[model samples]
Target chain A: MADSIEKVSIVISKGSLEGVYPGLIMGNGARMEGIEANLFFTFFGLDVIRKNRIDKIKVGTVGNPGMHMPTWIGAIPGMSWLATKMMSRQMDKIDIPPVREFIEMIGDSGGKLYACQATVDMYGLSMDDFVPQVEKVLTVGEFYELSAGGEIIFT
Target chain B: MTTVTLAGTPVEVDDEGFLQKPEQWTREMGEEMARSAGIEKLTERHWQVIDFMRKTYLDTGAAPSMRALGKTSGVAIKELYELFPKGPAKLAAKIGGIPKPRGCV
Candidate 1:
């Protein structure tokens, strides 16, 4: 309680729609609080900011016990689409935006978005593959340095 | 239920201090809740935000979250805290006599 939260830096490793939304929502929520917000996307998490995939991310029903069904049932064809549709419908009732629109909202509201250079290299993806919201690609060391003095959350 | 007299009339509140009924909410009750939340005075800006929250909740049947409040109420989040103290969204919802907004904790 001695130190007030001046900033929040979130790192995302998973790429599913459920995994990606927490970072986006929390980062956007912090920005709403007038705090500095930063999101670092790595590995599969890069899909969240990818130009081609950001709008197309889906729920990973496999092994997700929250689906309330067996793993094999979740793995059935069209189940992921069904899950995604259900999630989108549920979120709509709360006025929550879709992924693409949510990303745009954050960028327009001054939330910082970054991509991991190592992951970009590993996936052989260039800046063009990322959404225009990505400010830059930062190395792990640079992220660590910039994220200093802020609360770091791994999602 | 907890009862607190507002404008000389007793009103019931839930365990979390939110009003038990939306129809029981009034400007005086909001001011009382603001006072309890550590705001000594309800300024023009505070009323603006509170009125917007109340209107939105009435129309939508849901309390406005922080994001919705900030975007539509012409009030900044930091200023909301300054007006409502400890927790702005829940405090505003409580004052507005709306249910607590889920997914915003």
Candidate 2:
């Protein structure tokens, strides 16, 4: 246990459902292990904490090799929606809560949720646009200060 | 695995101190384990969670996930953390003499 992580800072930089879930899962897992966890949402990742679009995140079917389909087929009008629905069903079967519930669970377990100030400003978003679980908007310097002594994971 | 005495009864536990043979667990052992985990005292609410965990494990052959515990244990998530510090699902399972839950959630 000597090498066990005492804290973790995870950076989420994408808006796609697959992109956001890794950071969310990791942050929640760290809290479950009694480790302090912080999730920093930057760039498109802000969608995860945004009240208006949290549920609109869809699986990135186009250009995502993980989808295992041809790029042309992925470009079809409904492919992304179909892919997202299939993924959600699979996740639901495994008892994984939807994104909003997962975020609330992490926050309730003492994991801190943060939004990047620069991204919020660039996207014309304000504190009011985010979910109540978002603890704060942080500059990069403040994020580094908060993440001191912890591993920083960029997803 | 190792055999350790808890509440005057010897029981087998794994490396991280979870019970290796859950069937050998008793209520007195659970209280002793909880006390050692800095709980000091297991209140009625505490037993509610531990009992639910044991029952679930007995029924499902695995410890309940955190999501399941919160939804069905009748304990609010915030209170679950308060009742068992750190991680309620893992800690409560440990105190209840069950293996640590393997779920990712």
Best by DockQ: 2
Misplaced by over 4 Å in model 1 are: A1-3, B1-51, B57-63, B66-105
Each candidate's TM vs. the true structure?
0.68, 0.98
Enumerate the candidates' DockQ scores in order.
0.12, 0.78
- What is the per-residue lDDT of model 1 for residues A27-77, given as tens digits with 9 covering 90 to 100? 877765457889999999999999999878899899998778999999999
lDDT of 2 by residue, A43-116 (tens): 99999999988989999999999989999999999999999999999998887888999999998888999999
Docking class of 1: incorrect
In the range B1-105, model 2's lDDT, one tens digit per residue, is 889998898899988789988899999999888887889899999999999998999889988888888899999887898898678998899999899999998
Per model, kept true contacts as a fraction are 0.03, 0.74
lDDT of each: 0.81, 0.92
Indicate the TM-score of model 1: 0.68
At residue A23, candidate 2 shows an lDDT of 94
lDDT of 1 by residue, B23-76 (tens): 988888788877876778888988888778778888877777665776779986
Q: Candidate 2: where are CA atoms >4 Å away? A: none
Instruction: Evaluate candidate 2 and give its CAPRI docking class based on DockQ.
Output: medium
